[model samples]
Target: MAQSNPRKSGYSFAPSPSSLGAGLSVPVGRRSVLGGAVGLSAMAALTACGGGGGGSDVKEGTGAISFGSNQSDAVPKAAYKKMIDTFKKDSGSKVSINTVDHNTYQEQINSYLQGEPDDVFSWFAGYRMRFFADQGLAGDVSSVWDNIGDDFSEAFKASATATDGKQYFVPVSYYPWAVFYRKSVFADKGYDIPTTLDEYISLSKEMQKDGLTPIGLGDKDGWPAMGTFDILNMRINGYDFHTSLLAGEESWESDEVKDVFDTWAKQMPYHQKGGLGRDWQEMAQGLLQKKTGMAVFGMSISQQFQGAEGGEALEDLDFFKFPKINDEHGTDSIDAPTDGFMMSAKTENGGTAKDLLEFLGSAEAEQINTEADKSIVGPATNVDTSNYTALQKKAVELVGEAKHTAQFLDRDTRPDFASTVMIPSLQAFIKDPKDINNILKDIEAQKKAIFTA
Candidate 1:
């Protein structure tokens, strides 16, 4: 759920609850406590050793550093390589990359960090970054931020900062989650973009009548469905409620949360069948082949069409904000997750690692990245977007116009709960929508245990 870059777009971060829901108090107490707990050791280490190098044992550069990357997909992998190769050429430093499968890397990150992690590794912003940083698994990159901070927006910087007010992650790019379709498909079918929930349902019904699956959904990887849940939750209950629920400050068993599930269940008939057996790439392929009428997906789904052998698959890609469900919320919130890099707490060459981070946070690096992967935009505000594709530009506009932004369900909540509880629980609902009460009860119980522990 995150894409392409916009320079001078005035791209902002999450808005306060006051801005989203009048008179609603956004609770940061729980999130603050979590951040405090996580930043303690990291801050202590930073104080003891001084600056971003982390600790006394952490050494200066040997001109060579290893990197762990989860960008196994060909497009992003090659894109990262182009950026890294340029870094090597520009800085005269040696980078050894240890690439892992994306899902496997995320599943094993805890152990990977506890063991001998690379000097720097690909990571995400928000709760996931703070979670590891709090456990003393990541290096303080504040020093790197000092040099590159001017290149980014305040929101982008906040995304990289833990509750400790210290920087642990360096964001490179982000994209928003929205309903995507092929312009050609809409034109050929004379379909209109839905601006309200009723209109959305009506359009789906029309697609069904035309012998096309109304929605493309694939959850074999378990995380994709969270996007649907996220947009629905925001549209129905508002952004404040969505964030509070993910923070474990709200009961999953509440009627509000149940309403989100109930609504999604009603739309199941419109979604592709057997989603549990399909992956996102397959879903994107179906969209590209025009077998499916529409898909609620992140801009990164463009990668699938970008790889197609021919036709205007990539060129025809377009999206609209998920239609409004509540007049009060009015399509105000979106999931625009930030993806970036973090230095390992145990990096052998702290100096070299920080040096690499400094380069990665530069406008030059972001330019190189966006040039390779049009699906993602750079976080740096100074990035030259002269070459941005039409799709990339619109993505930036969509995110910038939104009143509130979320980091997606998995990134917004505890990693433990997301992977262990929500993933399977959502899959269960997809398999059998009637099991709502049971799913909510199970989620609440697991959330309590996880959050309290």
Candidate 2:
């Protein structure tokens, strides 16, 4: 099983070995990857990226470049190795590769970027990308965009661009966050897909009557629950509200945000109890065993189904865009985060970094990467969709239909707020649903301090 979480494994980008489905693609709007983690100066002493602990340079050949990768799962790791091998073959450059565990890499990114980041390194597209660009840690890739601009959708270009409007990230793949369910479970139960909040709630009640948990949630790692919160906030409050809220422009103590929690608390009876004790993989197991009806996550959820029975487990898995809560947003928005790569601003091999980024942004690189791993969709507009499975096609359609695309909560907000404040806050909310107002006030206080700093 692929075990990457944007918060857990840095997100699994390979299809579950069990499912025969082709690559998963979710075309989110204004596509970008990343969380706004620490806003430290990008010019800090080059310790992590240049140090032995980080992605240092490779002085092996006349034209050499180093790549730091976080696709740590066995399948995706192998896929990346193949990509690097192919790059070496095609470009005739001595490519040095450094691989790190996914979550570890993200956790250490600040130090990594400030230390000895590779010439090119794997990263996400949005606030995370922008945060780095704004800090001056990421290499300016406007020139690479000059060549590949028209090849991507404007949304993707927007994803690659920083707050200052310079392109710093190069997106290679993406997937959508949706409610995943077992087709067989729904088919045997004869339950229809609900479009509205009332119908969805009613459906949850029906699932409960059928002796199935309505939703499978695990927040032991703290980040999994954010998916649930993201969908609900977007559904109830709308996308713009969500973007502003994450940007720290809106008050966390508002009645609007509280309504999202109150409604969620009402549905708590149907949610898996003991969520704080379970991680997402355990929740996925509940769906696989028919103990639960559905889960809230990205296409990467399929990654949980691996091994000999992967095909059977995956064949039964299907997802729907999260149900609508309000007529205004009305299911027109989704969390479809884009994941890709960036470059160190001070890479000794500057020209080499740009060349590699150009290739990484190419349909050829997208093809190579997607073919090696089936967990995500190739981001290049021209990548071959001939091999797309029914589910992959559905994911693309779901995202393409969306009017607004939110990077997952962690990706959308400041890293400090997300990892430090929100993760524990949500986990605490799951543990004790009664302290809603206090939680909001505390979060707002922290947001004020962090944003001001």
Candidate 3:
């Protein structure tokens, strides 16, 4: 049985593993295999191609443009406010930002989608965007894309583009997710960050033996667990196979995917025993307090901890890329979800919004994001790394050098499939480790139904 939270948490369900059922199985022969340098070069070229416009089209206007975001921190709020101020000054438009509670932001977005649509808003890439785009709530940004050229990273732009090749959103910032642990704890245990599957398990076992929970998991939010599962899946099947599986072209029952879940089941015991019931914030607190040795989470969690407790405790915390699964496929990388901005189809100020989007891609907005601490990996635009901690800089370097970094499963796939198939499948797996095959079978069946329907 899944553990119950004593905290009376509002987010009770085990986070469904995938946000949208975007994962599909593709034939191995059709997968695109671009090296990291090639990928970056392509993105750079894309941006350069789009860089010729000036800011003359935007000036003060009478239109009041409302923006929305789920960012909860003062840092992000202040930085965003500064950007809004700049937008107002340059465009002569009255910009209003509605900051909502992070937990209820999605619901707010859903509600707003039904009522008065704002001019621009923040959204997750992949699955979430698909739902809005498909529903006609999001505007096609192909014109904006041509203007913003190579200013947007190819991967980031691809994230906002649908399979039909139309772009709907513009990315603001993105960061990599990984296992963050205390450097002192590793030193005390004489364990280095693992680079292979065997070493990973062995390290967890040693940590467990020393009376330390190896992972500070909080499935109460479900997303953190989903993040872990995504990383594991990416490593097991490789990015190409994982993408195909999410796109409905492949089966989850494949040996590679099964191995991924089986490996996760083996490590279940190393997680904090009651992790199934804890919220991510609480789990982060536990890790910061040193009650657990590690937490498989996004860089945002690190920023949250540092903000809540000050930087003193965070000095010992460092992160490592998810370990390589096998010697043959040795890319030390993990899921990277890019938070982006999009224009509403209903917005009256399309020109103003377009100007803001281009401004966001500039070095000025990138600096704002860095100083806001909203981005651990910072923006894709060129920025000085001297202000970031060594660990943060290291994460940026790893992502830049990655052979391929996928968006998280929930972010990459479709929402209905994510909520119905992916998340539930993971919950069922947690309920019964021996039921791994059944879980995959169920997911496979769901994928077929959704894609064929």
Between prediction 2 and prediction 3, which has the larger lDDT? 2
| lDDT of all predictions | 0.78, 0.76, 0.67
Report clashes for each candidate as comma-separated counts: 9, 26, 37
Ranking by TM-score: 2, 1, 3
TM-score per candidate, chains pooled: 0.79, 0.84, 0.77
Give the range of the ten consecutive residues with the poorest summed lDDT in model 2: 14-23
The lDDT, on a scale of 0 to 1, for candidate 3 is: 0.67
Candidate of highest lDDT: 1
Candidate 2, residues 366-410, lDDT tens digits: the string is: 777676556677777777777876566677778778877777887
lDDT of 3 at 447: 82
Q: Cα RMSD (Å) per model?
A: 9.2, 8.8, 11.3
Better structure of 1 and 3 per lDDT: 1
